[model samples]
Target: MSSLSTRFWIEAAREEIQDWENECSYCKRAKSKSAIQIMAPLPDIRLDMPMRAFAHTAVDYAGPYITIQGCGKRREKRYLCLFTCLTSRAVHLEMAYGLDTSSFLNAFYRFTSRRGVTVKMNSDNGTNFVGIKGTFEETRY
Candidate 1:
């Protein structure tokens, strides 16, 4: 169990323990060993793209930088809405005024107007994104 090959030692220890139950008192315990096995990898689905850029897209929010208004003392936080094409890796960035649904919708509008509607869009599971998910669902129905 103390060997540098932890997996091997673990399997060895497990087998030894199981064998201990069936062994007589006069017999020495057997060591259990594990071997590494190769596994077939899953196919890459991105290769089957529909021959169009931005058809499959991913979105994510970037920042919360503090920025002062034009010649004003007040500071405001800013966020970025990033849109990326899954196939071509083309990227589109839109500034989000805030993390609210309205701000996200505005950014989404700008992106769609420029790049056309996406058949599928992926986003991180952030609360702001979740809010937009509800908005999309509501608009769909």
Candidate 2:
């Protein structure tokens, strides 16, 4: 731009640069989101629940992290099923050997056995959670 300025005076140079910037793919990609994000109201479980650690909880799966078992070099992928108390902000981590409903059920049973039955549970509609939901629905009269 400094060298170009010596050749001729650019009228509305700022506007011209902005126009090019707006059209440039790299510039457009680099720009941060301009719209303000509106957060939803906090769920009742977070506010209205009793102070018990596992009274109401939110559930999510973390990852299929690599693990080595036994005295061999055998490695297996395992997921972490995270259970978080809404009001108490307490977290309980459970290892899930697989993403299947049975695996999650085992982990869930372990959690229930230790923490007792939760009054309410929140999830992000994950596939494993969906499968467990269907299982519960089927068992209900």
Candidate 3:
């Protein structure tokens, strides 16, 4: 075998090499010939809805009950709630000692100053919405 040409040795050993590879436990256990591939899903689109058909608003609270760090007033903490319009996605922000009338008014004024007059405004009805007056018609839930 040592005296044979390299080409001849390779040709002669090909069948034995294939047989050894098939019978070897490590090669059989570690090698794989087939695989499955998966793809991610796509987002859905709604064709019927026109963009910015009506002014949409969403309000959410940003904190739990607590006091201001340095003010030293013994009371519940303040919450920062934001109101956003869905159509234009315009935003209004207010910070309140408690979700009270004054805080809502402050946020409303800030929003109105930036976005101008909106025909409709939307927000969740908490105590902030109670007895509240505004120029824009409100749709509260």
* Clash statistics: count for each candidate: 1, 0, 2
**Pick by lDDT: which candidate is best?**
2
Model 3 TM: 0.43
What are the per-residue Cα lDDT tens digits for candidate 2 across 1-141?
677788989998878888999999998988857788999999777888575689898999999899998986889999999999898788999999999989999999999999988888899998888888867767642
Candidates sorted by lDDT, best first: 2, 1, 3
Question: Which parts of model 2 are misplaced by more than 4 Å?
Answer: 1-40, 138-141
- Candidate 3 wrong stretches, greater than 4 Å: 1-55, 65-76, 88-92, 133-141
What are the clashing pairs of model 2? none
Best by TM-score: 2
Q: Weakest 10 consecutive residues, lDDT, candidate 2?
A: 132-141
Candidate 1 on 1-141: residue-level lDDT in tens? 356465564557767865865685544333434669997863354455776788888899989978899887989999989998877889999999998888988999888888887788877777777877766777752
What local lDDT does model 1 show for residue 68?
93
**Order of quality (TM-score):** 2, 1, 3
Worst 10 residues of 1 by lDDT: 24-33
Question: What lDDT score is found at residue 26 in candidate 3?
Answer: 89
lDDT of 3 by residue, 17-99 (tens): 66887999888777856777796653222122334532445666677657646577656677787776665455566665566
Task: Report the error of model 3 at residue 74, Å.
Answer: 9.5
